[model samples]
Target: MADLETLKARKGAVRRSEIPSNVLTALNRGEIETVNLVEFLAVDHAKLFRSTRSQLSLDDKSAKLIAATIKKLADVGVMQRLADTGQVFHQVLDGSEDREAVYQQLAAHPSDVLRNWAAYMDAANAKLTFAQRLKRAKPFAIDDNMGVREIAWMCVRVPAADKIVSQIEKLHPFAKHKNYLMRRFAIELSRPCGVWTKHITALKERPEIAQPLLEFCREDETKYVQDSVANWLNDASKTRPDFVETLCDRWLSETNSKHTQRIAHRALRTLRKKADA
Candidate 1:
């Protein structure tokens, strides 16, 4: 298990001023952890990054190396920028001679953001094949930190987008994975409208293009994987309501379990809401 700091110490603060200076110092040193979504959003990533480079002993020119990403991080909203920074950190550190050592350090760090960068670095290794990239992300997909788990999927999302047809069959086996995290990763990678990441439009307009992947998880045992499958179908529902409705109907008839029932209910929520409206 990760040696997490006391979240209570970092709790109940929105702005930098609202937090104690010592707490901010601890945050910079990757000592304290963000306790919730609000604290995660409130973090000053650029400042945290400065400490990161310093601690890593990166070249002084590292700022220039990542300048373009720094600009995007500032211009974009909080969540988008956080995910973007993961990519930036990966790109900058990918070629170092000590990259493996550096990534190991980041992967084991107390700060969820730095650990997320470690996952991004592995996932963004252009040398890895699509299936290999999925394998590389296994650790972060199941990371104890909620933030690390969320960013794990976003890290590999775009590259996997183009290979949906060619590699999805290979990915199908993961739907039945003993580790629910890997199962969720398989579904999230193909989500049509995954937040703060590129969409798989093909999956949206033509839900059946990846039906084999979704079909395997229709009665997934874990609520974590079930929610991912349901959310993927819900995303498709906006564009292919007929397809979603028909598939949910079939699933209802074929499967009898609280799992499938819950999935179908949540899967049709958007369509159901529209009809009621």
Candidate 2:
């Protein structure tokens, strides 16, 4: 969201007349592969102030073309300059093997390294393809808050039901994250398409993990989680009345939300139908 004036200020003192044509061409085609074009600038570091030894001894027209190209690339979000290093960085927005590999590398590293790497990657392009990114992201999920958030977002983008179920099972161990991350993870697993009976049963078996979600439902804090729980209960109640009745009774007795009450009523109805039949 940077204004033209702000972006121009960041570029600093580079006259429109000092840029190169090849650089301009690369920028126009959105093919500036290098991170910092400034590094490739014509200035000669060894020969101080020897303007004659620069890479491209350009005239006015060539320089203007280069400047315009840089401006256009920056405006279109193809590249960003790192404030700390003052290096121009290019990000791959489209699905590229190179970009996917970079995320995989980041995912394998430790948390601190991963954070810096993700920031660098994000600067290059904000969105990533889920399938390409998830293989690397899965391991990092249990290790860091940022990783958990990234994995959660990645899970939502997965189209395959089996993949989603596997991811949920893998991430279930990290259900102990602080509220912010925990809430997101919980909601992601609660999706209708993502649900698996085995996964829910596994979750229910672990009181420590299941307890927080039950608490959230009892408190009626997140409507998404509540709705998910209601759906899960209703589905389970048809085939597993004993399990459903146990959970419904436990939750209804402990919490007072209208949603929980409604869930309890549904469970009771299911039980009565079973008894009458």
After superposition on all C-alphas, the RMSD of every candidate to the true structure, in Å, is 3.5, 15.8
Regions more than 4 Å wrong, model 2: 1-181, 187-217, 262-277
Residue-level lDDT of model 2, residues 74-192, one tens digit each, is 33321121111111111322343444444444334322223233444433343534343343344434445433343333333333334444444444443334544454455445433
Clashing pairs in 2: 35-88, 91-124
Clashes of each: 0, 2
The worst-scoring run of ten residues by lDDT in candidate 1 lies at: 1-10
List TM-score per model, in order. 0.82, 0.33
lDDT for each candidate structure: 0.75, 0.41
Report the error of model 2 at residue 237, Å.
1.8
